[model samples]
Target: MARPRRIVLLRHGESVGNVDDTVYEREPDHALALTAKGRSQAEDAGRALRAVFDGERISAYVSPYRRTHQTFQSLGLDPAKVRVREEPRLREQDWGNWQDRDDVRRQKAYRDAYGHFFYRFAQGESGADVYDRVGAFLESLWRSFEDPHHPPNVLIVTHGLTMRLFCMRWFHWTVAEFESLSNPDNAEWRTLLLGPDGRYSLDRPFDRWCEPESYGVTG
Candidate 1:
């Protein structure tokens, strides 16, 4: 039987990492709060989403990170209407042992070895690592949808790597193809529609400016 429809996805308005890029970050990493620009970006994202969904019920979930929580706060979603649940599985890739490294030589060497995030750092997890975790998360989410009362519209806030990996599976993109997707900007969300037939489709990312008139959805 076709399952009930649902929407699950990442949050908007958080930077790639802590500004001190030289640091070798560890799991439960350092703070990477959204900039002022990021907050504005998130607001716009919220506006766009509200326009699309209108009065549809939304079940919202967020990673246990300050940036993600703050992003939603900026959106001004009512706490009563949108219950925020935190999940560690939704957290960023734990970049262990790669924190606080001021050594340009080592950093450059590591970057070269990994080829732009292909390598698992000394104490860090790999993209594949995150993919595994998120995969399980998705599986559990689907199980809940099996319930007749599950909400039709859902939202999730997560990091770039996680989003990339999850979307890769949905779109049937290879590693290279997934890597080719634009790195989502802070406060830019990607929306997906999951059909009862178990098919996933991309809606739009938060960073992209979307006009209601453009989509012809009149409020």
Candidate 2:
């Protein structure tokens, strides 16, 4: 085995912070929990997964954020069948001190004006930083694929931006291509299947479409 036969990237369902962006102003990002509807969405996602997997064992790598863990729990996958691991590298981008600031709108505007991929927030990580970590994770994934004991199916539960960056890194998409991708909806998922060439290919187009914007920034 040189590549996982199947890979599923899932975004966590709506969290308290998603319902009220201002919650991050007071609560730590990692502490944000899921909403009631988010739980339902997670269960729905689990049912969809069960339909696809059909009793096949899966290895899951979940972000350390509370909401992601809660989403995984809500998926209702059998603990005896699915192997779960907490992956810090899959955690949400570190907003650092920016989380407590009230200027998120302005910061987002600045990022949009400049470049989301390279703009580093004040004392925070950039999209490129996240890409680097995800690249490392991909390398580890390839190694896992070569292991005899590795599971055939893999699941990764992570944040929206992280999921986008993971695809960019995995597929070697250009910055323009990366920027043109919108975040997947809460609890949404995408699949990749290993091809005959021993490489993974997207099973389908993203659920959402994004248009390319001219952000007056080069490289």
Using Cα atoms with residue i matched to residue i, what is each candidate's TM-score against the true structure?
A: 0.76, 0.92
Error of 2 at 13 (Å): 0.4
Candidate whose TM-score is highest: 2
Task: Judge candidate 1 at residue 49 and give its lDDT.
Answer: 72
For candidate 1, write residues 1-219 as lDDT tens digits.
Answer: 234355756555844454546433443353567768778877888877777656566677787877887777787665556656777887887756446555534754775556434656566676777777887887877776776766557788877767777776556555555444555756656778765566867876423232222233221
Q: Rate the local accuracy (lDDT) of all candidates.
A: 0.65, 0.86
RMSD of 2: 2.8
Over the stretch 1-219, how does candidate 2's per-residue lDDT look in tens digits?
645578999999999998888887888899999999999999999999988877878999999999999999999888888989999999998877427556776777888877889888776788999999999998887788777878778999999999889888878777877877788999999888988877788887664457655567533
- Candidate No. with top lDDT: 2
Q: What TM-score does model 2 achieve against the real structure?
A: 0.92
